[model samples]
Target chain A: MIERPHHVPERLGLLSGAAADPFLTEDLLRGVQGHGGVDLAKVVEPLPEDDARWAVEPLRDLVDDAMFQFKENRTDADGWLAPRLHATLRLTRREAADKRIWNHIALAVAPDYVAWRHLPTASEGKVPRINPVRFMGAPDRQCFSRLWWAAEMFRNGADYTPVVRACSNQDLIHNSLRVSLVDHRPTAQALVRILERGTATTGREINGLITAINTAGATVIYDAFAEDEPRDPWALRQWITDAESAPPVPRHVLPTGPDEEPVREDSVAKLTEYFADLFETAPVRGRTP
Target chain B: MKFYPYKRLNRPIALRVMSATLKLPDGTFDPLDTSAYSVPQRTVALGVAQHEDWISARIGLSATLPPGATDADAPWSGLRVLAVLTDGDTNLRTTVELRQDAPDSKEWSGQIEVLRDDHAGRASLAAYAVATVDGVEGRSITETDADWTVDVVSEEPLGGLRLDVKQAGFSKSAREWLRPYADVPWVIDTSGRLPLVMINTDVEGFSDLLGGNGGGIENKIHELLLSQMATDVWTAVFHSAVGDLEVEPDGSPVFPTDWRGEVLREMLPDVAPGLHVEEALRRVHRRRTDDTGWVELQTRIHYAAVRRAGASKAVANALRALQQMNREDSE
Candidate 1:
């Protein structure tokens, strides 16, 4: 019998030496081990691993695509990753609200990615640290959760185009997501229209417009003017039910969300015009008459 | 009480006692409703007088003559008349002083003056009295023909008026209270050791914490990186920080010292190669214009508190550190 040495090798062989080092690889493996395994079956509940409803492999594929597609420009990763992440991880709002599932994924499955993505700068003058909340927290603060929500909120009906636009402007997303008014589909789409129109170019402009809109909301009734379609509860239920047979989200093209009606065009148009006027009158920093 | 008697020789003297009744144009007893008098029976009694002949005698017992009631006094015009009456118990007291002047005309339209005293000797008189002759009502001076119309328009002595009260929320009070602090730019003090220590301490743990999936580290890192980049780009494009920068006296560098740009410059070399300062500046400019796409992806996580065993000192230190870093970068 060959005797195993007491001391193990300093590094573990995984990917190419250039691509994978022991520390990162070990950390990644440990992260997966910490939660059990990377199998979607292990992380998700009420959805078995082998069940058709379980799309863990497909989700893993999506993450891999994101890693490859955005290899050069990581900042550009969000636009590509958000909608895809949402598509791959098909979940109901109730399921998503549970922080445990997200915690399992972050801590147990893909901690290495979290570390890789979140490493602190040297100027920070401390060991790189992560907030435990990211592992399991509210959707707004969760690592993967915020992106999914952003995509979900900004997407216009089945179209993900507006999501892309809205995600592009970090200020808009950061500010808009915090505002309850953006839940109104027309308001979200109208904001995106403003961004697309180049009416709000700067962060301050976006912030100012958001502030003005929020302030104006105190007086004017936005819903009275910009009406939206009533949501069909059955559509979401149908979509979630269809998750068992749903195919992987297309990589090259933007995936379609539930077949809900898009925001009213007339409503969006009216808001676009109204918001434009507001932006004109808004007090943007350093903007002189 | 003096009673003047013109005797009809060997016959009973017939002296008719005249009394006057006055009514406001609205046909109401104005003084009875408004007067501070303890007894209001006098104005009602005068208001119900029957005829002109009864004016001089019945009114003489209770009511004071109006400004124009006697020719020796000035004519009363555009003044409300209130009938004054003596106490019922003192009906026999006839010699009384009229505090105000009597009206010059018999058809007098003026206020009647009355005097009164409590049993405690606290004597006071009505400021003015109203009197009108029965069967001789005067024409109303006002176009609106209001009842008991008094032309005595007096300005209130007090200058200010009380307005309606309003209620506000906690945030409103906070904003109002903090407005002064925000008015002038808040100059971050960088020389403080607390902020530096706190920032360094947090930054040390930041990397490890930021790593892993679904742990918000990635999002946080992304936000920090973008914020750092944005600070640099804004500085490059605008030649200043978006917010105010605090500087030391005599043009010396404060703690913040535009550290954001320095940090970005250090990281840019590692991220992209062969980039000159001019190119780097240009890149920042281009990113500023094109980077609107990343805004939505940025998530804000508020750090409620980072205290040590229920002590806020640690968190306070952390804030100081953040402020110091910001100040140094801006400088």
Candidate 2:
């Protein structure tokens, strides 16, 4: 186990691409002796003092547990980490969009977790690496952000159960996140529902479904047939207001989200049934017609 | 008693009072057949008459008039007649006059002054207002007439006219979710009217409306609704009226600061041009639908609460080892 920094800042800060460079040493990439956390701390700009929103400890605890639990199969860390991270972080979408915060988390607070989950193999012909972009990439490409956003889009209403199924397949996040089509709540839920129903099991099958849906989305007005009701803004306001008194998100169980209602069941079912049909005709590579 | 929106009281009514339950006080009930078209009865409906003649016939002959008082004492005249209504506590004195050119046509045109829209604004009034000289029931003032206007003389103290949707028998959330836009004078109707605030908000999360899936539910809605407000204030106020939209002191979205730039771009386009104006409006219409900005900021407080939780386990381990060595030497 690597030692955490003695003086990890109390709140989250912006660790920009330039600021994060020196911290990505070979030892840090390998999850071994690393010493620049104190120096790296200076460059990161602190968030508001009144806000207790940017604490780095729960995240530290979460990653520590994930690392300990998934030591044997490091890639499997994402399944446990994604939901727990989203639950622990409890961030709204705008907060997550700021890449600087993720940079701070990856390089300043828990570079070791980033390195552990994504450290590349040092094969004979290639140099071993953990790309800087993983620490400060787009939401889907960054290590923590990808997991957070995947949990956000995939979760149904307050339920994180769908997110578990979503993160179960690495290809779902890898392939689906890049496309903008997955943003529709019903569409996102339908994709997961199809996966749950065993409609598309393999990576290639899910990929084919995603491709078809994205293509169909441009022409079809999905909302016309499968309607989602208007949500009350007050519920969200109350939820955001309640953040101050919220208890720690339970580790063993998935935490509930803002009480905004789920996508209507019928809408999801309709989209699910529709997507299933789209998937059947979609071209899957290596399949015999 | 929220502002109750409705189908205009006096426009031509196609659907008449239906059912055995709706008989007039005189034991006469006129039910519309499948088409549901009929006028109100004279006893239950308001009649348009010359202001001078109506007051003299009804109020002038009344015992309520003082001794030896001439018709001049009455404030009303041929130019304006008051729709004398009272459900007792609520006194709605609507003074209206017919168009000068069409006085014989019997069509009262001009502003509807709601002196009081209390409980006095009855469901029956909405159905039975604007009847014939024989008190024949008439049409409802549908929004279709671009010229029709309801001028609220003063809604103060009692508050502005609202779509008392619950009172009008619309499905409702436990608590009121929308604020009444009193400035925009709306017609009183017994038919449950949806607030314009809701339809104007593009945040109407239709799946086909397709949001950024990865965005937080709060951010996505705030982004869409705030921009909708900027592009069209009258249209977007529903998002604000709903009580969920948070704006800065300057009235900008608290989250998604750049909301305007993107919102302006999307709304600037004629995004959905194929639909007719009425069709487009119908699509945005909401009836008894609950809205939520309904987002909460769940503070992940365990982070700051466990401030030292990020301190090096190695350093703590080293400190423990030192403590053990000192205790062993003492032993």
Q: Summarize candidate 1's per-residue lDDT along B256-324 as a digit string, tens digits.
A: 212333333443443334676435444444443465722331221001011102224433455566777
Off by over 4 Å in 1: A1-51, A121-124, A130-133, B1-331
Summing lDDT over every window of 10 consecutive residues in candidate 2 chain A, give the lowest-scoring window: A217-226
Contacts from the true interface found in each model, as a fraction, amount to: 0.00, 0.00
- Per-residue CA lDDT of model 1 for A25-45, tens digit only, reads 333332322222323222123
DockQ of each two-chain model: 0.01, 0.01
> Which of the numbered candidates is closest to the native, going by highest TM-score?
2
lDDT per residue (tens digit) for residues A9-77 in model 2: 667877654446566676666556556577777667778776545777777878888889889998777
Segments in model 2 whose C-alpha atoms lie over 4 Å from true places? A1-3, A25-33, A122-124, B1-331
CA lDDT for candidate 2: 0.48
Worst 10 residues of 2 chain B by lDDT: B55-64
